[model samples]
Target: MKGFVTAGTLALAFVPGLASAAEPVCLTQAEATSLVAYALPQAINGTAKRCSAVLPAGAFLRQHGSELATRYAGQKDKYWPQAKPAFIKTLGADGGDAANLTRSLPDDSLRQLADVFVEGLVSQRIALKSCDKLDLAIDLLSPLPPENTAGLIALTMEVASTAEPQVGKIALCKG
Candidate 1:
């Protein structure tokens, strides 16, 4: 699903110079890139799944820092756990196992999906923890819908290319 915000929604999402009434929860492009970079360690070590599951979403502030900061600031802990299963399924020795599950995907695309799936860690926010509900948000990001399995396939590709190195770098810097 390629993002579907209408002009109105985009406008509403961005009020004045801020990102709507929500403020930016803003992270500069560099910051956003760093956050994603830090996550790679988890993905590589097999702890990322567990670490990320318990890690606060606010921890990845670059992507949605402001919202999470405000949403979770001062809270004892803002951990998400429902995503445990998906995270486990994502790991493979060389990091190609998950991609192999999908047919005909490019290596680059596989890498991207790996990162997005990691980013998709948002499901940790909910208690249900079911893959079904987790997918709803992922589906929304798809912009292509089920009809475009190819598009979903493509999403992993796009997200991988843009999200991995950049955000991860920023995250390490912050840490």
Candidate 2:
């Protein structure tokens, strides 16, 4: 996970002067932060567990938004039985609950995970047409490997933290 690239690193991954190619999927810092805040929870909550593949974040999202969403939509109705069961199962698999997994990590680790999660979501939003459809976005973003559940939860906690005010405020479980 430490070796995984961050947003700024993704920019560097492109050739110099090809700014459009490297331009982050989230257009602004606020948008990036807001997207991270919104998507992190749904990801860890297990709604995405059915996701079996690892999506390429960053430019992939920028280039293939609609195609990715359509491919991941699967058979579930746009309106579903509910997403909570998946979230609960994901949380349970990680550590029995969100608090148990998140409360124990070092603060810096959580923040680092938050940074990575932010990059992933911004890329996801860019690919999915700027987060217009919550269900679709959730499906597209949920493709994270199951091994990252703890990291995802830690990132969610860091985003939700009140002490580090720069991350901005987030509302979880809106439904």
TM-score of 1: 0.20
Q: Assess the local accuracy of residue 45 in candidate 2 as a C-alpha lDDT between 0 and 100.
A: 24
Output the TM-score of candidate 2: 0.25
Give RMSD (Å) of candidate 2 vs. truth.
16.7
TM-score for each predicted model, relative to the true structure: 0.20, 0.25
Model 1 lDDT at residue 30: 35
Candidate 2, residue 34: lDDT = 33
Candidate 1: regions farther than 4 A off: 1-99, 102-104, 123-175
lDDT of 2 at 92: 28
Candidate 2 lDDT by residue in tens digits, 1-175: 2112222222211111112322212122222223323334323222122121333344333344344434433322321222222222222233555746654657556444443443344343332222223233334444653223223433443333223332222222322
Q: Rate the local accuracy (lDDT) of all candidates.
A: 0.28, 0.31
Clashing pairs in 2: 45-87, 61-127, 65-127
